[model samples]
Target: MEVKLHDIGEGMTEAEINCFLVKPGEAVKADDPLVEVQTDKMTAEIPAPRAGIIKEFTVQPGDTVSVGSTLLILEVGEQAGVPVKIEKNLPKPAVAELQAERLQSFAAVKRKRVLASPFTRKIARENGITIENVAGTGPAGRILDEDIYKFMAAAQQKPKLPAQPAPKEPAKRNDKVTSTIPLRGRRKQIAKKMVHSLNTIPHCTHFEEIDVTELITFRNELKDQNQTISATAFFLKALSICLKEFPVFNAELDEEKEAIHLLKDHHIGIAVDTEEGLIVPVIQNIEKKSIRDIHKEMKQLTDKALENMLTVKEITGGTFTISNVGPLGGSFGATPIIQHPQTALVSFHKTKKMPVVTEDDQIVIRSMMNISMSFDHRVADGATAVRFTNRFAELIQNPKMLVLEMV
Candidate 1:
């Protein structure tokens, strides 16, 4: 019996061959891991094609394969002469037509009436529009798109509406043909959650700065004891300590039925800057773990993040996320976007030396960092968010606070 591979996702057949765990002539049991495929959406490990001996193979490593595109021809052993049925989850005929229409053209006339979003259709109807202008506000200029007709109409109605900006589609750039990369993985989830958060929960950003000269000196002193400890690790330790006092920063916005619910767990997602992109892996049980434990976990998370084995679950779920780009480069000051549901995201920028007055009223150099706090105004008040940063600032400068709570 010949075995064929079918797609697991809707028309998403091709996948990057991550690795082949088995070689030809290898006897395998049912459900044994065989070909590892990295799809656009996910990585799947295709199992054995039945209780069979691999007769021949087709594709090799790093190959993109399509649905029904056989990876290998498996000759089923007589013991189980019946080949495993490959399941192809193609969309139904009508559904396929609808999807094709959606993918091909944004909106088209159907049954003497154009099938479009209510907004776009309304805009056309109101203006006595004879022609449907396919304006591609969407990526790739292909408008399977959303038409902001009300916004357009409202702006058009108001001549005083400050030089109604022309459509942004015709801008020319360097000889490069620009293309939009779809938001995938963490970026996709982040975009979705951000829209949901900003749309549902009101957001207000607060900015502040922290004088960390004392913290710098103390961190250097600790570096003498343990060279591996980073300023970022030290900051995480400090933030954890301060969070214990500021319980409101630990609360989450409950969108359903509208209420703010307090969660006791402080799972901190420390934003590690990997060569590929920024990833925030959670340091679980932050309140339970000591500073040393947090440091070790940060290192592990950083390493895994760079290596790309951290998994999807590792990249998500946190009451708050701390982005420590301070050590990498760029001087203090950045307003980071709040990482949704949590109501806050803290950005760490580079600390620069700036002149400041001391207790004795003399000018002195202090290491200053701009703490950009993006918080949901609905959940945390401007005063509360600023106060949280103020507390975080104090905790860092007071190095004693970091180690004091460690024991």
Candidate 2:
């Protein structure tokens, strides 16, 4: 029987196949991971549909499949021949499930059978407490992640606080303290992806500096006329124009397969680092939009990025990406890792004052920003990347191009 891909998250219509863990005719366990599907927003590992031999696999790596799409067929193993229907991972229940669980527990178990997940139960047992004694604070008293944190914090006797120090002797030496930050959520994912990228992809870095004093002056002039426009909005208007002539910057190389994939649209992801680590929300069909539209959408994307309201579609599946760490308060160009598969990423520090001269070689102050870009050596050469970056720098350095775009 063919196991079809189902809607794993709300509003998720499709997913791009990222990797295949099991090959056809491979035997697998009940919950063994089969393939990984990366939607625009997140990556999920599909588990075995049943403990079976994969009879036929329908999807390949990089296929974009919508919900309810056929994914694979399997021939059930003998012992599990009854057909082990693998239930897809589900989000914790909503209001209706909460109410029903509450009703069932109130009348049926009467709080005797503490509703804790398997791992939580293990923690409870290790702490010498029975599941029934945990007293869950989760909906319908279903123990949750936070509940575990609270329990863990309470179980062990914490170290006592030290008294304020008396006058220390001059001989006292400074002592070093070591701290271990716990890995959780996106930070954890970022760590994993970074390691994967650094290990798997053959990467090369390039640096360039462009004087953009003219661009700044032009942006200010435009803003004076159109008070609501933003410099970034104007710059992107110019970027769209450059991309029309050069498409290599808009492509990706599949490292494992050694082939370049062509992206159909210009959806540029601007990497925004928050307390939630790096989230790259995309601006879709950037070339087709005007400066006003780009300005509005950028504002919206930034807000969504801040509030964590961005959907998977909003965050993933872009061919090109630009990351600005300037807003984070840095003003120096820095190296950024290439988001694997995507051939390149453009990054820069906040704009800063630097020394420059006009074509006449007049000594002067210029508005300049350092440009840092990372590229996949397998996909794009340095010359092509430099040309792409220069086009962006040219537009930024000459802001009048923006006015022409709107006209």
Candidate 3:
């Protein structure tokens, strides 16, 4: 049977093949990873539809295959039969030249000696670098273009003596070559999502500087008790509580249906930056989870994200998102883009000790953090967003609120 590229969601019609996990004659089980494909949203491993031995791959790595296009041929179960060739609709004459070039390039790539993909080899050629010299960092030590960039960066960063004279031969002298990296893989996916989110979603950002002096104090107390909880865990708890009052914040917009999806379950997505790119893995039912629960689950997801082991289930179904760059470094605040379909996204920066005025009108030093929320103007107005932020700030400012539920 021909294994065609099935519907990989988020309205993605085509995907660039990244790597094939199985080769011809390789034995595999149903749902086993057949190939990893890079879509506009994420790089996901397409699992096999049935247990079979791989017959052949119609598409190679770096080739762009559309939905319903033949991906591979597989012999499934006991009886093996030749795949029946189905007639496909002829493409327009305008695209014939482009398609021919793509096919020619793919065929030429098959004759290359380098282990790197055609795209990676193209980058190497553009930079006038030998593909054999560049070390591979990807699986099976396959040379990736990123490894080339890293190599270039390292070479440029090397200190040279000011008194050193230039070599007589033009080719002998070491000079830096500027290379242009074609945005592909995870970075390209992020770029598409960001552009779409910004263009489609009319974002309204509301910033708040919360005085978390008491919250910090309470967290420190918990740390002493060996019940270490991150500030993000507390924030999640507060945000989940606020979602109950502000359902719009936790909703999804279906512009096609001309309706709003007010989700009851608070499946909050936490944006995590990894070596590949930024990804949000949802923690299901945040409303029922306590501070400890959030902390534990967040850690597990974060570790998986960093390791590039997050499953499709973990990356989808987020009703809302939080981007906490606090641990990364110091930042005032960031207006994070809403994780579309979801109506809102919140950003939390590093907490710093700054001077603050109490209700008694006395100035004192307090632990402060800046929080920013970007919500869809269509689903929520400025006033609604402000109210939600204020309520969230109020919960975080008062340690007693979070302390009551601390495990």
Question: What local distance difference test score does each model get?
Answer: 0.62, 0.66, 0.76
lDDT of 3 by residue, 281-315 (tens): 88999988777889999999987676565666787
Residue 106's lDDT in candidate 3: 33
Q: Evaluate model 1: give its lDDT.
A: 0.62
Candidate 2's displacement at residue 359, Å, is: 2.8
Task: Give candidate 1's error at residue 124 in angstroms.
Answer: 52
Higher-lDDT candidate of 1 and 3: 3
Give the candidate number with the greatest lDDT. 3
Cα lDDT tens digits for candidate 1, 1-407 = 44445675433545666555556655455565567665533345677656555657788866666677778776553433322333367557855665554333222211121223222332344444421354545444423223434444545742122112244455576645444564443344346556766686566777787888887787678778875567777777777776777777777867677778777888888876543345578887688876677888888877766545465455555787888777678675676766666867778888899999989999988888887877777766888777788888878878777666777
Q: Clash pairs of candidate 3?
A: none
| Candidate 1 backbone clash number | 0
Candidate 2 lDDT, tens digit per residue, 231-261? 6676667767766767776787665786777
Say which prediction, candidate 2 or candidate 3, comes out ahead on lDDT: 3
Best-first order by TM-score: 3, 1, 2
Model 2 ranges off by over 4 Å: 1-177, 255-258, 403-407
